[model samples]
Target: MRIDWDVPITMDDGVVLRADIFRPVEPGEYATIMSMGPYAKGLSFQEGYPGNWNRMIEAYPEIAEGTTNKYQNWELVDPEKWVPDGYVCVRIDSRGAGRSHGHLDPFSPRETKDFYECIEWAATQEWSNGRIGLLGISYYAINQWQVAGLRPPHLAAICVWEGSADYYREMSRHGGILCEFLGSWFQRQVVRVQHGTGERGPRSPVTGELAAGPETLSEEELAANRINPGQDILDRPLDGDYYRDRSPDFSKITVPLLSSGNWGGQGLHPRGNLEGYLAVPSEQKWLEMHGDTHFSPFYTDHGIALQKRFFGHFLRDEDTGWTQQPPVELQVRHPGEKFVQRSENEWPLRRTRWTKYYLDPDGQALGTTPSSGADLSYETTGDGLTFLTPPLTDELEITGPVAAHLTLSSDTTDADVFLALRVFDPDGEEVTFIGSNDPSVPVGLGWLRASHRKLDTQRSLPHRPWHSHDEIWPLEPGVPVELDVEIWPTCIVVPAGYRIGLTVRGRDYENEGVMLPGAMYPMKGTGPFLHGNAQDRPAAIFGGVNTLHFTGGVAPYLLLPVIPG
Candidate 1:
């Protein structure tokens, strides 16, 4: 392979974004795969992310044996794996980060437009073949949706590997509660590689050069160069034109798509992949949902094979038989990280039997029969309560979106309800799964801020209650109101003698196990996805006594999409 280092991509407005291109040694035009992200292009995966790198290598050995990995960037494809296969790989440092020069504005219109121009510039290159496909996870994957909406002519295909499409719903806020990820992410990851990091930041171990920039700058200059993402997120509590402009319009994306979501990614990954596949105007689209570490799967033998098949068909016009593949592929999860592969023509499988399990206040059980005139209250800041079903007599498979209906009153004007769908072994041990970010987390998780309980009826389904977070309706203190909480999609198969447990808490879900310091996101009570901002959920508003009303005429229940075994 031949590497063209520090190539300048001049945007229409005269800013030059730096890119590195890797092409086959043989002189011939080839379809291109590119990633445009704020993460420095020169930050070698092994050196920059040793924790994830070590874990990924141990789990998927073939990944390291497959290539030299010299060209590998975080969450991006290795050039060694693709360049030899008649594909050119390109990595561009988004303006104001890495070697690029400009005021850093992450995920803004300027960044999206610059990405569009970069795509077009790549198409015009001599080694381009005029066909480019976007490939990566998270930041790299998210921008593909945005640029694809701009509809660059040479953009042929896209592989959205665990990317969130909606900025507000998936990233900044969850059910109207502001999460700490945006702030933590900008500080830990973005700021280090930002344009003015200069001598203040770490260098590229491999290149023995500054990864953030070529020139050193003062502390004041560094601070002035970038936007404070966390504060920016806090200031904009409501989703408005700022977020709308940052988020991509799926309606305008018509390219062939392979949308891969992680079932355990309740935080940011699952919703967008499923929603994008269902909403994109693309005639040929595929959805694949898996469970495991967010980054490992993309480099595993299985992931690369699937990606090659899709690009083979769309970009090269090769009959790789990807078209004959099922429209949806799901890794139906089970205990001990086991999964049963299932293929279908549509999502939420047509055979799904939507069932509601009523909350019985008596024995803290989930059943079909409703109890009467019962009110169960829990401390808002405490480890709320757990409702379980009798150990299953037969295997139960749940494979789609989950929701809950609750009739409740709080002493305060607003409250936060955190729900966790858990699994318990016959031996009485709580079972957890590997999430996109967390090492151990419940099977499924759902959250809602009582004030933002208004539903988007047109987009709501029995199993998936869509919330319109545009406005907040403060409750009359101590007044009962029905609220529909939207839980992200999950897939799990329960064994006979095992039990399904639902835990509702005032705060984020917490697991009892090892927390990796090297995780992409820090493992907080809920794996860095906690929503306890002082501004969004003040102690006075969300810390008051909350009550769950059930039985009587009002039946509070949890909805599950049970699939036939």
Candidate 2:
């Protein structure tokens, strides 16, 4: 079906953000699906992000079938699918990215205002039926939370797929530890598509001018006009207003949303999706969790159907057979790269029997009860302690976010605790999964600085733990302090003959036999001392001789979200 594409909308600021509008040529109004973000609007899935796009298409071949691949953009709804279904799919280049004006700084307050304006503009178009919805993955998804909070009049609904809510926690810092993802991400992706001063890049197939603007400025003019704000991110290490402005205020977001999360996306995406789903005040919300390569399912036939169903209900006012659907749909992950579909009434499944395995210092094993009064202490830099369980006779599935409650005395005022969940086979070999950092790594991991363990009870959920970065709780030299460490969520199936183990250490988890494979994108290195490197973590910030005090009087345990067999 031939549809009108690459339509331009001039914002209030006189900056024209280009859009690819796909709608039926027949004289009929249709609901609209709009997305605005970086990652270039014209860059094809097969050409721009080949590694990710290829994996996605390979796993879901139907994505590439039956349509001209021209309308496919990175990390957003495929226009071909939505346009033919009596909906106009609109893709906009956010100001400063792709074919948009202004400087390239993501999640900036200014950019959010632009998004709000863009939404209203789309709503007023001749082809729009006064209803619009936001749909996309990652960048497009992340910003929806921010804009939805603004409560645009035309934003009828949103499908936030695998987007993060807390910028500092998910994107910048992991457990108060600085992640190199921001720096590497900026260098590799953002800079390339940044709006330039000249009429470069793919011209709008409709306008024939540069997709961004009247490309009249020189390269120097483009660079000079942009805001090079990378330094601000590096300087701010806490959850200050800078991060807050970029994050979504859950209270203000009331639009119906379908929040999607990935089971294996521990580093940046999954946590926020879960957080947004739970935190948003929207009573009309749904949660869908899936397992697969990060970028695949969002574009697949299965994923598209879900997106269309949700958008159709909200945007088109169509009874798309989605109302009776389960509120939560999870692609329950199984061993050997298999997935089973499961429906649930709510997240952290009501039947999720929260089991706590206490740390037995004497035998270094995880048990149901504490072995009273036996205090054991270990060097902060040493192997620390491992609490292991014997091989299970039956298959066990542990999914969702895990936490560790520790009662410990530290030698110094501050300490860092690194928690790792490892699966060991009968022969004692560690089971590893393909991680973004390392191809072969443990199933799940989490970390926390002992002093930074203050909890925000109001924000904390049973399955998800939220920390208050409001103040630091200093260690009392030798007095035992109770601390809870929040680990990123994961889904793993431990078959019979495999043991579940929790390793509490002072540093990051680096597999000695594995060299850090060059990531598809560059990431900051953790430094020489494997696990938590000392260079990235200095004595002043993370320096402290830590100790784990586990005894009979006080039980330190790992909280597991074990799904019933």
Candidate 3:
């Protein structure tokens, strides 16, 4: 294989972006696989994320089977593996984050335009067959949706592996609540390797060049060059241009697409994949859901083969058995770390029995009958409430989006509600899974800030409440109002005698489970996807007691997508 280091490609605005290209030695116009992101293209996977890297390698030793794994980068296709398969792999560091020189504004229209221009450039390259396929995980995958919407002429297909498409709903804010992950992530990942870090940042082993940039700028200058997404998100409380600019218009994403999500990737990954598959106007689209650590599965043999098959069919017109692939593929989660692969024609499965388990506030139980009990109140700073179902009489499968309808009131003007769907064995032990980030994640999670409860009826599905975060309607203290909370989709199969539990809290969910040895963060139920920002949930406004009211001409229920055989 041939490797080109730091190939300069000038954008329309005259910013020269740097890309590393890997192609076959005897290449004669091959289809191109490209990724453009803030993550330094030159930074190796093992160096950028040592914790995840070591864990993935230990779990799947075969990931290092073939050619030297030296070229592998985080959330990107391994050029060593793909180049031999007759494809050119190109990785470009988006302007301002890596070796590229420019102002740093992630997910901005400027960056997307740069991606589109890069696609056109890659297609025209001598190693390209004029067909470009976008493939990556997380940040790399997120931009695929953005550029695809622009409908770049040379773009042929997209494989969005665990990417968040809705910047507001999935990433920055969840159910209109600020998620601290965005801010913390910027500081830990992006800013650390940002342009101008130079001598402070590590060098790429392959090229022996600074992974950031060549010049080291003063701290003040570096701060001035980029926008702080955390502060920006907090400044724009209401979703508008700020968030929309980062999100994708699914209707305009007409390319053949494979939107892959993780069942345990709460907070971000799941919603976008499901929404993209359901909303995209593309005639050929597929959705695949799985379970595991965020980056592990993508590099596994299973993931690489699936990606190659899709890109193979769309970019090179190869069969690769992709023509016979199902529109929706799911790795149904069973207790004890087992996943059963299943293929289906559509999401929410046509045979889904939409089950409504009414909430009995007094008894703290979920039953078939509506509650006739009194209102339940809990301190906003404490565990709100938990409603559980009786042990199941038979095996049950829940494989789609989940929702909750509740009547709530607070002594203050607003309330932030955090909901977690969990399962417990007859012995009373909680059944958790290895989430994308969190090690002990619940079955599903949902959040809603009472103020931003207005729904976009046109976009709201019975099992999914589409919040219109365009405006905020603060609550009237002591007045009960109904709220529809949309839970990120999940897939779980519970055996007989197991029980389902829904815990409503005022803060991020916590599981006192033992943290895995190499886990990045504490194995709390929510992982690093936290939302306890003091400014967002200030003491004065959201510190009062919150009430869950029912039985007085009011009913609260959990809407579950139960798939039956």
Candidate 4:
């Protein structure tokens, strides 16, 4: 393999972004695989993300097979494995990250335009094919959706693995409630590797040079160079240019797409992947939903194999059996962390039995028929309520999106609703699975702010309620308002004698004794995607008694997509 270190690619604005290109030594021309992100390109995966890397290496020993693993970077394709497979791999340090120098603004239109220029630059290279394919996890994948909307001429395909494309709804805010994930993420992950950290940051194990940059910058200078992502998000409480500028116009994404989501990824990934598949007008697209940690699966044999086949068919025009690929692929989850692979023609499966379980406040149970019951109320800071069904008479499978219809009233002007779907064994022990970040997570999670309950009727579906976060309709205290909450998609197959549960909480859900032991932050049930921002949820306003009223002739109920055998 031939390696080009710190190759300079000038952008349209004369900003020269740096990239490391790995390609076959005797290559004439090959499909180019590229990723540009805030994470330094020179930083080794093991050094940049020690905990995740160590855990992945321990869980899947096969990940260390056949390669040195020294070149691995976070959420990026391993060059050692791909360069030898007749593909050109380019990893760019996006403007103001790593060695590149510019004003750092992630997810900004400027960064996306830079990416467009990089794709064009890679296409004109001596050992590069005119076709460019984008492949990466998280941040890398997020940008692909943005740049693809620009319709770069050389861009041919994209594989968005575990990424959130909708900045406001799926990322910064959930149902108009500000999420702490983006702010925490920008601080812990992005700023740590931002350019100018220099000598203070870790050095690249491969090159023995500063991973951030060559010059150490003062704190004041560093602050002036980049925008505060967290504060920026908090400032824009209502969705407008702030988020619309960062998010992709899905309809403009016409490139071949392979969107892979993690079913257990409660907060971030699931919505975007499913939305991309359903919204993108791409003539050729596939959606694959799986179960596992965020970083591990991207490096495993299964992930690489699927990527190769997809890129092989689209980029190289080689028959890698992708011609027989189905429109939707699901790793159907079962009890005991088991996943069974299955394929279908479309998402939410056309044959799904859309079942509704009425919420009986009096019994604190879910039943087939709507029951006239008393209203249920709880402290805004407490575990609101848990409604469950009796043991199933036979095995039941719920394999798609879920929704909840409820009539709510709060003492304050607003209320934050946190929903958790869970499954329990015959003995009543709660069954949990390994999530993208958290070790144990519920079957499905959803959130809503009563003030943002106004729906985008045109975009809303029975199973998925799309909220127009553009405006807020403050709650009239003590007055009932109907809310249709859209839970992220999930897959679970419960056996007979097992009960299905739903816990509606006033705050982030937490497992009694579960915590991601080496994670940068405490990842309870909902990972780091907590929504307890003081400014957004001031105690004086959000801290109050919340009620679930079963009235207006429409009893509250849970809408589930049950797939028939």
Candidate 5:
């Protein structure tokens, strides 16, 4: 392999960005796989993120197979895999991070422009063919959506692995609840690799120089140059131009895409992949969903095989038979921590049997129809309400997005509803699994601050309801309002003698079993909020005496996308 370091590409703004390219030793002409992001390029995976490296290697030994693991970095494609295949694998440190010059802020318009110019630059290089493709995980993947919309002339295709599309809806907030990940992530990861302080950052193994630029600026200059897009999100807690500028207008992205989403990434990654797949105007597209650690499957043999096949067909015109592959491939999850491979023509399957399970006000049972014309109310401080189905006589599968329509009244001006879809065995023990955020988690979860329940009609789907969080409508005390709760998608099978359940609470879902090892991040001042916690839900903003009101007159019901047996 040949390593080319300190490769400079001058952007339109005259900012010189740095890149590290890994290519085959005897390369004449080859397709280029590129990734640009903030995380320092020189930082080793094991040194920067030991937990992720350990988990990835533990799950897929093949990742450590073949060439040396020297080129492996966090959340980007492995050069070892691509370099051996007669392809040039390039990693660029975005401005303000790594060895790049200028202010550091991710997904900004300036960064997008830099990415667009970088693609064209890679295309015109002496060792390069005009065709270029983008491949990476998380940051690298997320930005692809932005740059693709810009439609760089030399860009051919992209593999967006575990990236979210809507910056506001997916990354900054959950069910209209503000997220603290922006601040927390910036402090923990972004700030460390930010450009500045002359040569303090790690040096590229291949270059022997800093990753961002030749020499870093002073702290004052670095801060002035760096832009914190996350802080903008926190400033504007609603859908506005600030968020839209960072979001990809799928209609503008015409490039073929292989979008891979994680079934476990309920917080941000999965929603983006799904949204991009459905919304992007591209005629040639594919979707793949899997269950595993966030960073594991993306770099695994299975993931690499799929990515190469897709890119080969698009960039190399290899005709690798990828066109014959299924459009949608899902690793359907089972109850016993197993994934069942299934392929379908479309998402939310066309033949989805939509079943409505009504909320019984009397016994808090979830049934096919309403039990009586009586109101069921619960305190905001108490277990709001629960509805359950009888034990299944046979194995039943449910695999899609879920929704709930509630007629609720609050003692205060607003209410917060937290919905959890759960499974229970014959012993009545609740079944849980490892979620993207929390290890001990439930099947599906959703949340909504009652005032932000207004739906965006054009964007709402049968299986998923999109909210118009652009504005809030406070409630009148004791006045009933209709709320459509969007329970994030999931796949599960309830065995015979097992029951399916739904819990409508005023707050987040708490693990009923043994607690996992981690500091608890909860809602309000109460227990940990597994779905949307306190960092995102300040009491002054969400604190209210919430109420779950139900009756036959109101017809509150939970919608289940059940896969008929």
Candidate 6:
């Protein structure tokens, strides 16, 4: 293997971005897998994301079975692993990051253009055969959608591993509430290593060189050289031109794609992968969903083999049997924490029996029969209400998007509703799964701001209703308003004795149950996907009494996509 460090790739505007290319020593032309992102290309996985690295190696020992993992970058393929497999792996420091020259900006129209240029530039390189595939997780995967929208000729395929496609819905705002992640993440992770931060940032352990840049810049200059992404997100609370420009136009992404998502990543990961697979005009596309730490499964033997097969058929034109692969692969989850791998022709399998479990105020239990016209109210600032199903009489499989219909009133002008689809074991203990960032998370989650209840009827369906965040109508203080809250998809197989549970909360969902030990980082309620930003939901406004009214005419129910056995 030969690695060309700091290889220069000049963009259309003549600004050169630095890349590290790893290709076979005797390489002729080979299909290339590329990743470009803000997380410095030279930063080691162990240093940039220690918790993920440690969890990854522990769960998938085979990831480091042979190679030294010396070239491992966050959410990217190990060059040593892929280069030896007869493919070239390229990592580039995107403009404004690492050694690249430009103002530090992320997910902007400019960044997408830069990515397209990089793909074309690599196609013409000595170690390339004109075919290029984008690969990586989150940041790396997010840009793949953006660049593919440009329809670059050489962009042959893409493996989007747990990435968000909608910059507004999936990332910045969940339902219509503001998520604090994008803001907090920028301040902590990207600011210091931004382009001009230079020598002020950490040095590379491998090359013993400055990770940001070769030349240092003054504090004032460094601050001015980068965009304040978080603040910009805060300023634009509504989903409009700002997010649309950063998001992908799926109609134009026709390249073959392998989109993978995690069931636990409610705030961002799941929505994008599913939407990308279904919306993109790509004729050759596959969707796979798994349950585990975000980065863990990507490096597992299972992940590598799947990736190789997809790229093999598309990039190398090899008969790797990827052509016959099912359109959707799911890891059917079980309460005791087990996975049953199943393949099907499409997402929301045609055989899915959409079941509605009606809310009965008495005992706060779930049943099919309409409830006695009972009214239930919980303080908007409290734990809210919980409804449970009797232990299943038989094994039940709920395996698609979950939605809720509630008729409610708020004492104030608006209310926030949180829905948690959870499972409980035979021992009566809550069942939790590994999330993108949250280790202890319930099976499924949904959130909706009462005022943002306006639905797009043309795009609306019983299974999933698209909410047009274009308008907001506050609740007539104390008047009943019906809402359709669409919970992100989840897959779970409940045993005969276990039970399914629903918790309606005024705030983010949190498992008051025992937490995992030795957690590297603090993951609060709803994990990092929280949306309790004060600017969006001020206590003065939303902190009021909330009510759930149940009756035959206005029954509140949980609609689950149940796949029959």
lDDT of 3: 0.90
Return whichever of 5 and 6 wins on lDDT: 6
Alpha-carbon local distance difference test for all models: 0.87, 0.75, 0.90, 0.90, 0.79, 0.86
Cα RMSD, each candidate: 1.4, 3.7, 1.2, 1.1, 3.0, 1.6
Model with the higher lDDT, candidate 1 or 3: 3
For model 2, residues 1-565, the per-residue Cα lDDT tens digits are 4455556677777877777677877867789888888777766766566666665566678988977777676787776677778988888888787777776778888888999998898788788898989888888889999999999998899999888888877776677666666765665677666777335555544345554444566777766766544456556656689889989999899999999988766677778888888788998999998866566778777888898889888987789898988988988776566788888998777888788888877778887776544666666667667779978889989877888888877777777787888888899887766443334556677877666687889977655667866566777787888878887888888999898999877766655544433336322222221333344466664544565666534578888998898
Q: Sort the candidates on lDDT, descending order.
A: 4, 3, 1, 6, 5, 2
Error of 3 at 386 (Å): 1.0
What's the lDDT for candidate 6?
A: 0.86
- lDDT score, residue 363, model 3? 72
The clash count for each model shown is 2, 6, 0, 0, 12, 0
- Listed in order, each prediction's TM-score against the native is 0.98, 0.88, 0.98, 0.98, 0.92, 0.97
- Ranking 3 against 5 by TM-score, winner: 3
Can you tell me which runs of candidate 4 are displaced by over 4 Å? 513-517
Worst 10 residues of 5 by lDDT: 520-529
Which 10 residues in a row give candidate 4 its minimum summed lDDT? 512-521
> What clash count does candidate 2 reach?
6
RMSD of 3: 1.2
lDDT of 4 at 366: 89
lDDT of 1 by residue, 259-372 (tens): 999988878889999989999999989999999988988998889999999998888889889868899998889888998788898987899999988888888998877665
Instruction: Give a tens-digit lDDT track for model 4, residues 392-503.
Output: 9999999989999988999988899989999999999999989997888899999999899989999999999999987888988899999999899999999999999988
Candidate 1 similarity to native, TM-score: 0.98
